[model samples]
Target: MKKGIVQVLCGEGRGKSACALGLAVKAAGSNKNIVVIQFLKGKNEETEIGRRLEPEIKVFSFEKSERPYCELSDEEKQEEAVNMRNGVNFAKKVLSTRDCDVLILDEILGLLDYGIIEPSDIQKLMEARDEDVDIIMTGIVFPEELNGCVDKISRIDTVDIKGV
Candidate 1:
């Protein structure tokens, strides 16, 4: 099996998640198994790509509350933290098992930024990932610690088109 490298996608652009989803579709088209773990997003099957790609692609979300992290009460924050921790554990298990060819950690950077998960947690996930499983992470800012570890880092910037 060919070795798969880690890829990070981040920036102020609007299509980070969309790009990840597109890749999931492409991978599915090639019969590659995919697992997407979304952070900070509530469960909504109607808008979920994983739901549409069921049986081929699996998605798990760590969102326990619909409220924004910044606006959450201390108690709610604590609860969300637990859910995020569980999500991290699940991700570690998936990576270790190597059950899928592709793994997408959607909005994981936001989790780090919001203190939902620690930077060390991400490091652990990267270290535990199987050699054959490609990993994709999408968020607004790339973690500095992962700069040297990831194989490719793509930053998307929005272009203002006043009139099109």
Candidate 2:
């Protein structure tokens, strides 16, 4: 059987994006095409990590601003939401092409929390996914109904962060 999509919803501590990046690196080592779209976090080290790969993984970020040091204003929040929606749409287009072997949708849960991407839209995308591509989606507060369709579901619990 073909390896299936891996949905990792890590709400707690660390290693969410790290895990995804690790998978991407492994896939790239085997010469698989990889695409990563980070909804919340972007342009950090992980984004850079993919760049050094021989084939150079394609990395896209819909987040326009650097990580906020303080709480965001309503306008900034709206802007971020717009970026997230664009990211989702871009992912949809990429998926529609069905070209790559692995596609990563990072921090999509946060987008949903901020009321950016809707679960229903994601449901539609999953319904339409190409069986050949392996997908990894990281998010929080997973919708109650995504029970059977997802091949793997992992919920990372919260852990306290130290000395931020």
Candidate 3:
């Protein structure tokens, strides 16, 4: 059996999500099973890439509303916390199933940013994943605790473009 390694794409660039999506497409094209769990995106606001890969790729979201975290009220934040917890549980289930060849945790670092989930929680998930399931995490800030846990880490720096 082949072993699947963990890959992290993090930093302040615009292509983090795009990179993950591209990987998903490529994996699907190769007949590999892929699952994507988005931590901060809402159902209505999910990117078209997810929609386009439907059936071939499974996409799940934890967001309860379209409002950004900065704009959410205390009550909304509380509700979001529940949703985030659910997302964590869902991820655990998926990882344990070993049904997917690739598992993409999209913007999962945002949960750490909001203090909704701890680094230890992520560490536990990483430890529990199937040996053959490739885990890809994309976020702006990578947790220091996960420094040596992943096999590959790619930092994306934004390059300013004058005009499109």
State the lDDT of candidate 2 residue by residue for 80-164, as single tens digits: 7787788888888888887578888877777767667677877876766788788888866666676565777777765556954
Q: Quantify all predictions' global Cα lDDT against the true fold.
A: 0.84, 0.73, 0.85
Q: What is the lDDT of residue 144 in candidate 3?
A: 79
- Local accuracy of candidate 3 as per-residue lDDT tens digits, 1-164: 88999999999988898899889999899899898988776555454458677889988887777766657889988898889789888888888877689999988888889899999888888988988889999989998778877999999998878964
| TM values, all candidates | 0.91, 0.84, 0.91
Candidate 3 clashes between residue pairs 3 or more apart in a chain or in different chains:
none
Error of 1 at 121 (Å): 1.2
Candidate 1's C-alpha runs over 4 A off are: 45-49
Give the Cα error of residue 135 in candidate 3, in Å.
0.5
